[model samples]
Every structure is written in structure tokens, then in C-alpha cells.
Target: MDIKDGKIKIAYLSQVPAPYRERMHELIHQDHQFSYDVIYCAKLEPNRKWELEYGNYKMHFLTDVAKTFRHNNTNVWALLKKLNPNVLIITAFKPTMLYGVIWCLLNGRKIIVYNDGTFNSEKSISMIQKQIRKFVYWVASSFMAPSKGTNDLYNSYGVGNDKIFRSCLCVDNSVFDNLPVRDREFTIMFSGQIIERKLPLFFANIAIELSKKIPGFKALIIGDGEQREEMIERLKQNNVDFEFTGFLDQKILPKYYSRAKLFLFTTKHDEWGIVANEACASGTPVITSVDAGAANDLIIHNINGYILPINVNIWVEHILKLLGNDNLYNEFSINALAMVAAYNHQQAAGGLVDAVNYALAEKNKSTQSNTITA
Candidate 1:
């Protein structure tokens, strides 16, 4: 907690080397204020197709866990023991992170727990699960959150402003900048895995309705998953003109994201849809469901985009309205760019450091109080 000669040794426990998070980690590593190391449970998940680009930073991957989608407590414990960090950052509430929490508790080290979940996404949590989260919240020295929904979630568990820090869930928005202005390609676009929660069939339904009113309604579908075939079949049956680009690399995504007139995110629940961030960064307006975590922070209703319920009729109405009205679409596009400008990698890294510093400061204060009592 004393920062041991001006650098607090920090260890982060994460699920994977997520592309969006890797950049933020690079920025945090560049900061001279703290010694940072990211210990990943795995290199990639079973579903992800990310092309990870590791930076010149301290990164350790659990080899045994990398092969499978599970974490070994022994590996996690051994790594934490070896790191012996002043503060440990836990990125999720899984069993793997629980092991880290227990290690931190036994070692008397400070802990900073990051929360990105919202009540809507966690509606099925049992009472026991809530109690476990409450316990984790109690053990944490500080909390890091990306959106207001996550902040409110922490507040609901009795966390106060003093212990909460803002680390926005962001991507490199600058990448989308400076692309040659070209005519928008697709009338509406949907990006993300074609899984049940993403509601790809619902998007197809919207496309069907829109094609009835608008001439030549073309939809763009990006990414792939178990539901890809079904989604495609539905779209075909509806006679909707569409294109499906299966699981593109991170670098190639900007071209598609930037070309769409309206980015449609009809998800049942998302912690924070990074695709929405990508869409806005590309100067394309978005129409997302209210259940998306980005709806709380990034997409302002009727400003950058519309955050509506999962009603097909309503989605079709808004899509038709935006596509028909050029003035409104342009206004939304401009606003989307302006709104996403604030959430960048730099800001996210700074927020993590702030949370770490706050935790160390609180630990030092507690140490002083104990010393006085003694």
C-alpha cells in the first residue's frame, strides 16, 4: 500500500486477451506510476475469433487453462503468490476470480473489482448468487465500472461514490477516422454473434417489414455463430436482400461498420456492446434495444441513436423514419461521433490507475488507523 519506492505492483486477473482490453492494458503498462501485469485465464474463448496483438508489456497466460474454457485454481493461486502484488484487479465474478479474491483476502492485499454487468442482463441471478456478489463487493477495496448501469449495480450492493471509479468500456475510436468518405453501402446492418441473445431473427423480421415500405432494403450481417444458418434461412425466406460476412478480423471490421447507414443492435442483453461503439465511431447512427449496456452511456435516445424496446414494429418504424429523413440521419451520425469521442483507450487506462491508487490510499489509511489503535 505504501507504493514501495513509488510503484505499486499490480496484477490483473482476466478471462482472455480481449482485443478491446489489450489496448487499454498497453496504455496502463506505459504509465510509470504502477508496475502492471495481466494474467490471463486463457488466450481465447471457444466462440471468439479475435486476432490478438500482444504489446510490449508483462503478460502471462495460464497454459493449462488456455486449451480449455476453464481455469485452474492452482495456476491462479501460484501466479498470484509469485506476483505478490500490492493490489489485485479482478475482472469478473466467475469461480476463477473467486480464487483470486480468496488469495487476496488471505494475503491481506488490496483488491479492485471491475463490474460491467447490469440488472437487466443479470435478471436470472439467484439469491445465493446475489449474496456471493455482495460478499465480493464487501471484500473489494474499490470498484471500477464502465457505464452508469454498472455504477448503479454497485450502488445497489451498497458501494458508495468514494469506492467507485469510472473505466469506460471503449475501443480505439480513432481507427474509424479518416476513411475516405464514400456512399453508404447497406440500408441497415447487424453486427455481433448470431446467437440467441443477439436476436438475429428479430433483425430479419425488421428487415422484412422495412423492405415492404422502402425500395431495395439491403441488410448487412457480420460475425457468425450457431444461429447463422437459421438467421440466413429466415432472411432468405423473407426475400430480404442481405450480405453475411462470417467472423471478420478486427482490422477489417471498420470498413463494414463505416459503410452502413444504420447499425441495428437488437440484442436481448449485453453487458456493453463494443460493436455499438465501433458503429458510432464510424460516423454511422445506431438503433439499439434498451437492454444493451451501451444504451445507458453511449447511445442517447433520439440523439446519437434510438434505444427502443424489442418491438419489431417500433424498430421498423424508427429504421424507416431515419432512412427516409436525411437531415435526422446526418444529425445522429454527427452526434454519434461526438458522443464516442470521450470514451477512448487513454481515458479507460487513466480510470484503472485511479481505481488502483484509491485502493492503495484506503489501505494505507486503514493501516494507520490500526497502528494508532495498537
Candidate 2:
């Protein structure tokens, strides 16, 4: 239990090597509080197009022999056994990770469940699935959450507030600073996959409606997916001035954010939208859906931006209001940057360390109690 004597060995199991997560893990390694190892199920998920570089921390990728795998495979068990870490952090709930949880239970290793799911996003869970999560909740030593909504989710599952830790979902804020200023050519922007859940068509509809009121209104659409062609067709038919940039890399993505007047996020359901952080860091206001998990923590209603339900007419009205008033737009933009300042890589790393230390101490107490009874 004495950290000065020896470091805690931790195995952080995740789905992919996302750039934002790698940044946080790099900071955790620099802290030198624990021997941290990041174990990824795969190098990248099929749906993602991020170009990732591994960080300074120890990383292990489970071999996915199956050519068509969803998230994980059975190889996690062998790698976990070989690592034999003192603590295990579970971020995904695939069968492989479920088995890993069982393995940790048998070996008496502490398990911390890191989740981003909110009450709104998980409202439609079947009874059997809810029971499964309830079991996992009982077994986990502690929980790590990003927002108040996620905290409410754990509380609803009967997990006490004391056991929940805050590790805000964040990105590297440095990348978004001091960029070359460009003309705000695009009046509105939508940055995410063009699939059904992201509501790309809804964004197009809003843009079409706005163009009718504002002269020469232009929109910027970033990302590509199965529904890209259909969304593009809709915009073209309505004579909406828009440019579609398909799947931008993380490095140059901020350039577009800087050139846009506002960001529109209309996801049907999202645990956390890191894009909201990027837009705010660039001093751009966000108009996001209430269903997004970040709405509760990142976006302050009427301060930084407005969080409203997914309705075309309502969204169009807000967009016109913000664009028409220069003073109000400047106020929202300034407030946005101020609000997102706390969400950075260093703060996220600190939160993770606090949770790890707490879990280790609780596990030690449980061990001592069992020994005394024996």
C-alpha cells in the first residue's frame, strides 16, 4: 500500500488506441505513480479512421486472428495472464472483457469499471441486459465517469457516490490553440460520421431551412459514412451551399473548426462527444442535442451554447438568432473557451490516478478484513 516503496501495476483494457486516450495515458506514464500498461483489443476499430501513434506507456494489442471481429477476441485472456497486473480497468463490455472480469474476480485483483454511458443513451436496455450490468456493477471495486449524467447512471444501479470518480472525457487542448486565423467562410458545421445515429440528414435539413432566411449561407460537413451520398443529395436538391470533407485526420481537423462560425451536433445518442471540446477550444460555439452526454457537463445552456431537442424548426431559429447578433455570438464564443479549459489531458490523468489509488486502498482493506477473520 506504500506508493513510495513500490509502484502499483495496472492494466488498462480499452477498445482502441484513440488519440485522445493515448494523450491521457502518456501523461499518466509521466506522473510515475504507477506502472501503467494499455491493452487494446485491436489496433483500430473498423468504423474509425483515426491515424494513431502509440505513446510512451507500455502498450499491448491483442491479436485478432478472426478477420472479421467486432471489438475483441479470446486472446485477451492469455495476455492478461502474462501481464498479471494488480489492477484491471475495464472500458468495454464484450464477451472477452466479461471473461476478463471473471478472471480478475478469481485472482482477487481489483477491478475499476470506466464507463461513458448515460441514462438517456441506455434507456432502452432489455431486462436481461440490465441484469447483466447490475451484476457487473456489484463486482466492480469502483466506477469512473465523465459527466453528471453518467454519475446518475451509476447511482441508478445502486452504486454509491463515494465509489464513483470523475475523469472528464477530454482531448489534447494544445492542438487547438494559436492556429492561423481564417475567414469564417462556413456559417455552420457538422463534424461526425454521416450515419443514421449522427443525424446528418437533419443537419442538412437545418442548413436548407437557414439558407432561405440568410443570404449566401454556407455549411461545412466533415466525415463520411454509409449515408453520405444520400445526405449530399438532399443538400444539393435544396440548393444548400455546403462542402463535404470526408474523414479528416486529427492534426489538420482544427483548421476547419477555426474557419467555421458555429458547430452543430445532432447525434441521436452519444455517451460523450469529444468534438464538442475541440469546437469550444477554438472559440466556436456549439449547438448540440440534449441527448448527448456532454450536454450536461461541457455545453452550458445559453452561456457557451444551446442544448435543445432534435427539431429542425427550433434549431433553425437558434442558428438565425446567434448568427444575426454579433455581440451575442462573441459572448457565446468567449464563454465556450472558458468553460472547456478545465477539460484537458493533465486533469484527466490526475482523475484516473486518484481513482486507481482509491481502488487499491479499498482492496487492501478488504484483504486485511478477511485475514483478521481467518
* Candidate of highest lDDT: 1
lDDT score, candidate 1: 0.82
In model 1, the runs with Cα more than 4 Å from the true position are 1-5, 64-72, 177-182, 362-374
TM-scores of the models, in the order given: 0.93, 0.92
Off by over 4 Å in 2: 1-5, 64-72, 177-182, 362-374
Global lDDT of each candidate: 0.82, 0.82
Root mean square deviation (Cα) for candidate 1: 5.0
lDDT of 1 at 58: 96
Which one wins on TM-score?
1
Residue 94 lDDT (model 2): 74
Worst window of 10 by summed lDDT in candidate 2: 365-374
Model 1 over residues 72-168: C-alpha lDDT tens digits?
A: 5467888888888999999887678889999989989988999789756766889888988999999899888999888888988888877787888
Q: Model 1 Cα displacement at 338 (Å)?
A: 0.2
Tell me how candidate 2 scores on lDDT. 0.82
